[model samples]
Target: MITNDTMQASSQGAQKVILTIAAAIILFATFENKMPGGMIGALGAMAIIGFVLNYIGDRTPIISQFFGGGAIVVIFGSSYLFHKGIFPTETADQITTFMKSGGFLAFYVASLVTGSIFGMSTQTLKKAALKYIPVILGSAAVACLLTGLVGMLVGKSFYDAVMLIALPIMGGGMGAGAVPLVQIMSGKTGMDAQTLMSQMVPALAIGNAIAIVMAGLLNKLGQVMPSLTGNGELIRGATAEVESEEKEAAVDLKMLAIGALLAISMFFFGTLLSMVIPMHPYALMIISIALIKVSGLMPKAFEQAAHAWYKFVVGNLTPALLVGIGVAYTNLDQIIAALTPMYFVLVFVTVLGAVIGAGLIGRMMGFYPIEAAITGGLCMANMGGTGDVAVLAASRRMKLMPFAQISSRIGGAFMLILATLVVQAIA
Candidate 1:
């Protein structure tokens, strides 16, 4: 007896409730006792959730349509609530400072750059991505380990100082992965990290465009290359293929300026809210993103900007910063103890929920398989980046090029705000 509009309305309401709960949980964990070590437990949970979700995405092609990169942001917001909810408040100044500076701005840039660069010149990078994906990912793992070791070893900085670098690395790694690794090794300042991430928006937008181009090239290759066609229909074989169609980019300079102004405005409003509502500094960002999205002007902005400053930074940057800030001030060991035990259960289940739900929705709505896969890919990558996209792509056997590029930026501007609210709920 439920109508589609009613169902959608219910879904929206549920999202709001879920976000509030997650924020409450993250806040509670912060207050009850101190988190020690890294947010190892929570992060590990995120990793597993990330892995499982991508795996599901690859396997269930139809669902990918809706699950695309959006799922990634969605997963973190929800997970933060269920697992990290032992405490009830997130008003710790240390956590806020850690997040606001390092992770906050850095992630924004990383997603945007990755998206834009990939979006425009989809061709060249796909070749490079095919060649270097293995190395790139491995380098990423090694980079994470090395960064952690170096940070721990230099050990010269107190909690306050270490965070300046730590949060940036975490945010950057979560987005572009390897680039941030190099930046730190080169002795760049943390401010450099934020600037680098901001620049990443355009770079990746170009890269994403390239990815779209690559999908076309690969489609041609599919005509000549291998096929698993029992039906022998040639192009539309068993292999799941997703090619992004290029529309006129609604990219606009004016909209970019507006979105930026809105974000800054939200920052100020959030500051005001912090006094009365106890919101975090980045809360403004989340709220700003939501307002932009609900208003639905993002597409116009994208085309207006010529795909220049697309909104990758929102979901990814904000959460990475929030979690990074929390991690910066927090002791990893204690967090490991508090949250790790629940990792496997929480991570897997939530991912399963998204994959199953999004996939079903995509298929029921008659979306193509690859589209469904990209939809699910969002569960991990929207805020996180290549790690999430790569995992889903490989698992789904998708042409990572166009899907990765277009999918990341699709609904991108708004997802950031939605993701932040969800993450804040966890906090």
Candidate 2:
């Protein structure tokens, strides 16, 4: 018989294997049912992106950052345009029929809801739903304003449907979640309903992918950015909103409970209120911040729960989200002629602009180069989504994790809102 320690080690190894197997099973089972086509395509896409990223990352960092996105845009955007007859479409009726189907509609909505749900980084039960508001709301508002302008410029009707994709890419895609708000203009009081719906689906897919990549790229940049956000974990007031190094210490049951309550309240209120207010999340964020503030008011305010709550509100959704994205995008080759060039232009200009803008904005707020750069990249990612941000952030080895995530998410909400407006106007 084996010694006691050997037995323990064997058991431990078995448990680890079991856990890995379980994780895989859960992932496939979830994807098999929830996402159409399957996760194979999704995994494939990630692999392709990863391989290309690896190669390019070693040579030209910035180029690698924007490389994959262009292809997504071309395939999805072209298919959408052809379906809508904006381009030379084959069997426009079929395209329309497929796009307008309930299955496609459900897919889009499910992805959105899941992305939102899985993205939440909270521990409290209630705070789960509320977590999506500020970002989404900001996304909606900014989208609306821009949409109105685009609509005004593009003659504002069904003919302008293709523009929705612009917002998704512009926001780095995760923030492109706001594209659904394009439906706002499709209502009885909104623009042509069919037109808006047609473009929104693809925008959701492509944009989210872009967002993921943007996140990655931003993280990569932080690895190379001049060190600046490396300040010590000073005695930050123990708030429920703490995102600093002390997050581990700040987590606890009470804070989690509070976060859950807040998230739930926000979702309930957001849904309830979306009916009445155009600028929906204004109240949501203000209230979330207020509550987050309240939770931190006492001694153990955000002690442990802050981190826990954040996890509940926004963590571990990337794989599924990406898989869903990959499954739907069938035409990989077309990406070259279709999406990359424009996406490259957009990302380059936007990054350059954000860098300049963040510098100005940072000076005003008293942050440093790395802090501002990471934050600016984060804004780009969230406005774009996680994939893009992740790709951007991870492009380098010594990435600034926290700053990149926080800033991108924060900026994502705002940028997406702007994107929505621009998209709606065009749609």
Candidate 3:
């Protein structure tokens, strides 16, 4: 004589029991080093660990409110775990290899970039494109100015402050931003690349950490001052158009497969183009997608399919991706070593300046201040792709992936060029 509500409760309880049992088994296998090799074991371990940390982070009082909730927890928690030898060596190695050689991050980003760009209305894309670069430039300029002035005040040279500290902080990430700048500066100044790297690495690490925290703070600011943010939207007055474009459709298994294929194909084409273009594949992919969207060449159904695929990946894999990032990219030691009071202040000001400058310029160009700051400012200040994911996830603004990519890839290229010019002038 059980009613429908009772039956539903019973069903839910049973599902929870089943899920708990599965998670327990995975944990046991992972700890015992008995898990299967390859993607199956790696993904299972990441999902279980990531989900548990995420749950705890989301409910942890002030952390859930001001910090990045589960996103930040997953990152720092996983890094701490890995650093402290809590995560099994085999398990750690597996996650690292999977993230890097396995190319999971790239795969995830490809889906996001393809789907997000396709999901937007051509009009919105065009409008945003025309205004986005200016915001990036404004952010970098202010960050450099602020950090340089602070350096001079602290008895450091303005050249070192701007070129070594501030420039690397806004250069994108380690590989694309700092590394290239180091090479360029070393070539111009006749300094060893290793020495240049030693200086730049700490700045990149500290800057990335500040950018993540700032993202969370900005998210909280948006909550407190609703007028400053469009929630996740970047451009203003385009909500109606974006909403219309984002209207969900019934997506079948075949359509999802099609969407996945399309995303991968776009990434593949971008990779192919990069060989000749001397630009990042991501930038090329974004440009190609934008052109396609603007030309009205892609069919409506395919666009819907791509968007569906993006939604699926974002909904299911984000926490796991964060775990991968934590284990693979975050260097707790580097961050710890760079925690001097003065050094920390410089990095903080650099990121803060980027946020403020980008937000102000973005507002002037019809963009939401918070959203603009997160994408153009914070993304530029972060460690590139991984940083973009971490910051965006922290801010709970995953829909802005396209713009974040632009900040990381296109904006990063601009920094490299600027670094080249500055190095030549100084030399």
Candidate 4:
């Protein structure tokens, strides 16, 4: 007779086979244009496609070792599929509509931000706030200097290089960085905002792609030079008090629901406050959450719930979100149209400078070099909130979400101010 252990193994193997066959059937149906319609069809298609790409990337040798495994593959692969019309049109449109109009990206990030802030120790949070801005500044400074110098070598002016390429690359993302930046430059230089946008969009796109790859490389470098990283931790000498707390905290379905509600409520509050704050809703939400955490006002149960909710969302939805990012946000044609040897080099140098500058300064401020660089440098170079998620996920440092948001929202706001001054000076 078969033993209990053997019986369990056989059962698991059977379950896997059944799931695989079901997945194959769904995918085949999808390809044949017979998939279900609306949200079910869209989500099913994205989840299935994303899971397969993620699995391949994770198992592929070089990709698993250095290119962010499934995160990279899900993003780039989805983009390619969407571009080639391989994804069903109805499903693709639904995914895009869900990501953009349905507010899935914001919903996802709000959970992370709320949960992450609640999960951190007050001391670590305070220290990070103190040191993070300077790191962003250092990264931006070095990136601008390097990109401008390279621009001169490429027959472009220093101002154009810094203002057009470096600033936009480091300015957060398109809406927060390039759009307002174009308007500011237009007012200063008498050029149309649309014209300025055309010049800056390519730089933003290329820079974001480079930042993602660099995040993966940095993760690999951390593995090779373990001392330079804290694995997922940001602060160098900080104890794992949060992790211990998480282990001790009790979780249930009620707690998870509470956490979800708290996350969305904070986001709503942020939107309400934006009327008076003159900042991004995400920035306001972060500030609000940070203040609440620092004040010790929220109940311990609620905090634990929020953190648990965050963990749940991240574990279950990251790949799906990346799929949405690729199909909804990425522009293959724009990236290809902007490709040129000198331009690529300039973009690469800008991102490289950000990593170097942030890493060095972050180490000085008692943060792990790799963690600091990924948050302060790569986040700024990415496409705002979405880029932050992609980069942090690629680096396998999801716990650093709080710091990454600070870079995108707060650092991005700082860039807008800097652009104003630079435009006036250069124009």
Candidate with top TM-score is: 3
- The lDDT leader among the candidates is 3
Per-residue lDDT tens digits of candidate 3, residues 1-427?
9999999999999999999999999989988889889999999999998999999999998888998899989998998887678868888899999998998999999999999889998899999998999999999999999999998888788888888888898887987898888879987887799998888889888888888888998999999999999998899888888887666889999989989999999999999999999999999999999999999999989998999999999989999999998899888998899788888888888999999899999999999999999999999999999999999999999989999999999999998999888877778
Q: How accurate locally is residue 164 in candidate 4, as Cα lDDT from 0 to 100?
A: 87
Ranking by lDDT: 3, 4, 2, 1
| Best of the two (2, 3) by lDDT | 3
Error of 4 at 89 (Å): 2.7
Candidate 2 positional error at 33, Å: 7.4
lDDT of 1: 0.35
Per-residue lDDT of model 1, residues 131-228, tens digit only: 32222222223323333444444542232211222222223223333253325422433345555454333322222222222222223333444331
Can you give the lDDT of residue 329 in candidate 2? Answer: 37
lDDT of 2 by residue, 103-183 (tens): 332232222322222222333213322432233233333333444344445454422322444344334343234444444
**Candidate 1: residue 296 lDDT (0-100):** 50
Q: What's the CA error at residue 224 for candidate 1, in Å? A: 17
Q: What root-mean-square deviation over C-alphas does model 3 reach?
A: 1.1
> Sorted by TM-score, highest first, which candidate order results?
3, 4, 2, 1
lDDT per residue for candidate 4 within 98-122, as digits (tens), equals 8888888999999999998998888
lDDT of each: 0.35, 0.39, 0.91, 0.89
How do all models score by TM-score?
Answer: 0.28, 0.47, 0.98, 0.96
